[model samples]
Target: MSGYLMSPRQFSALKTGLFLLCLVPLANLVYGLLSDTLGANPIEALTRGLGDWTLRFLLITLAVTPLRRLSGLNWLLKLRRMLGLFTFFYALLHFASYVWLDQFFDWAAIWKDIVKRPFITVGFASLLLLTPLAATSTNAMIKRLGGRRWQLLHRAVYAIGLFAVLHYWWMVKKDITQPAIYAVLLTLLLGLRVYWMLRRAGAR
Candidate 1:
C-alpha cells in the first residue's frame, strides 16, 4: 500500500470518505440522544460520550504528523485540520451539555464547580486553549499571523492534549483503563514532538 499513489482527485475523494466516516460516531450519539437510549443518566451519558469523542479526535489529529512522517503519506496532513476541528466541535457539545443540562446556565454554580473540581478546571482550560486555535484555523488568520507565529500559536494543542488527558484521568473514579490508554498515546505523541525538536536543533 505504500507504493499506492492516488491522483489528486482520488485523494480528495478519499478525504471525503474519511470525513464522513468520522461523522458516523457523532451521528450515532445524536440518534441515541433522540431515542432516549443514553443509558441511565442521559446527561452523564451525553457528557461522557462527547468527551470521549473529543479525546479520540484529538488523538487522531495528533497522530497525523507521526503517521505522515513514518509512512511517507503526505496526504494525511490534509485530514488533520478537519479532525482537529471535529475535536473542537465535540468539545463544544460536551461543554454545552454541561452548561445547559447539568448546570442550567448557572454562572455562579459553574464558577464554583470549576474551582472545586480539578477535572472540570482542566477540561475548561483545555477548551479555552482550543478556542483560539479554532478561531484562527482560516487562511486569513494564517496569512495575518504569518506561518511561524501561527505555527507557534497552534502548538497550544500540546497543552490542550495534556489537560484533556488529565481531565480524563482525574474524572474517572475506579475504571482507569481507557484514560490510561489515552495517556500512553498522548505521551507517545508528545515524545515524538520532543524528539523532532531535538533532532532539528541538532541539525542546526
Candidate 2:
C-alpha cells in the first residue's frame, strides 16, 4: 500500500481526539461509581466494565495494522501502543477489582481461585503475559531489543487476545452474547493477519 503523510497539525488533532475518546470509559466508570449507578452489584459491574473495555481496546489495537494496510492511513500506527497500554490499564483495573473486592487481599484464596477456576486461571495468566508486553512497549525498549526480537516478543499479543476472549467466554456461562461478538471480532482480526501472511509468502 502506498503511504501518504498526514500533516503534523492534523495528526496532533487526531491524537488529541483519541486521547479524550479513550478517557471516556474511565470517566463514565468514575461517574457511575460516585453516583451509585453501576447497578446493585457495583464491584461486579466495574470488573466486567473494565474487562469489556480491555477486550475492546485489544481488538482496536490489533485492527490498526489491517486498517493502515487497507486504508493507507500510516498515521494509525502511532495509536497502536497507546491503545495497547489502555488495554493493560483496564486489565489492571479488572484484576485489582477482583483482588481487592472479591479476594480481599487473601493470597491463599486468590491462589486457590486461580488454580481451581479455569476462567480465572486463564484470565490471570493473560494478565501476567500482558505485563511484559506493557513494560517493553517503550521506544527505548524497542531499540534495545532490536526490531526483529521486539517484533517477536510483541507477537504475544495475538496469544493474549485469544486468551482474553477465552477468559470472557468461560466467565459468561449463560448470556454468551458479548463473548460471541468478541469471538467474531477476534476471528476476523486473526483471519486478516493470516491472509496477509499468506499474501506475503506468495509475493516472496
Candidate 3:
C-alpha cells in the first residue's frame, strides 16, 4: 500500500503516543530494581536490559527507512528522529548507571575500565559517537549543516550500531544467542543500506 504523509497534527499525536510507549520499558526496569525483583545482580541486569533496548531502538530507527521504502509508507520518516533520540536517551541512562552505581562516579576508574575492557571501550565509543548526532538533531542544525552534509554526518549511526553490537557480543560470556540475534539484525540493516545506496547510484 502507498503510504501517505501524516499531517502535522497527526505527527504530533504519534509523537506523544510513542513517548508514552517508550516509558513502559523504563518503568518496568525501575519497578524491578526498586522492588528487588531483578534476580541476582540487579545492577548488572538493569545495565544490560537498558543497553539492550538502546541498541534495539537504534536498529529499529535504522530499519524505518528501509521499511518505509519497501512498504511505500513515507510517513515512517516522521518517527525516526524520536526513535533515534530515545535510543540516545536509554544509552545515556545505561552509561550513567554504570558510572554512578557500578563505579561510584569514579572518572579515573571508569577511564581505566574503558581502556582495559574491550566491551566498555566499544560501548563508550558508541556513546561518544552518538553525542554529536544527538546534539545536532535540530531544525536549525539541519539548516546550518545543509541536507547533504547533515546526512553524511549522521551516518555515524551506522558505526554506532556496529560498536553497539560488538559491545554486546564481547560482553557475553557463554550464552551468545541474544548477541548473535542482534548481530544478524544489524547485518540485515547494514545490508539494506548498501542495497539502497547502490540502487540510488544506479538511478543517478
Clashes found in each candidate (C-alpha, N, C closer than 3 A): 0, 0, 0
Question: Per-residue lDDT for 15-83 in model 1, tens only?
Answer: 899889988887998899899999889888888899999999999999999989889987788788899
Residue 120 local lDDT, model 3? 93
lDDT of the structure predicted as candidate 2: 0.92
TM-score of each predicted structure versus truth: 0.93, 0.95, 0.94
lDDT of 1: 0.93
Candidate 1 — worst ten consecutive residues by lDDT sum?
1-10
Residue 72, candidate 3: how far off, in angstroms?
A: 1.2
The residue ranges of model 2 lying beyond 4 angstroms of the native Cα positions read 1-5
Error of 1 at 3 (Å): 9.0
TM-score-better candidate, 1 vs 2: 2
Residues 1-204 of candidate 3 have per-residue lDDT tens digits of 347667778878988998899888999999999999999999998988899899989999999998988888888887888899999999999999899888999999999989999999999999999999999999999999999999999999999999999999999999999999999999999998898889999999
Candidate 3, superposed: residue stretches over 4 Å from native: 5-7
Lowest summed-lDDT stretch of 10 residues in model 2? 1-10
Which residue pairs clash within candidate 3? none
Q: How close is candidate 1 to the true structure, as a TM-score?
A: 0.93
* C-alpha root-mean-square deviation, candidate 2: 1.4
lDDT string, candidate 2, 61-82, tens digits: 9999999989987778888999
The order of the candidates by TM-score, greatest first, is 2, 3, 1
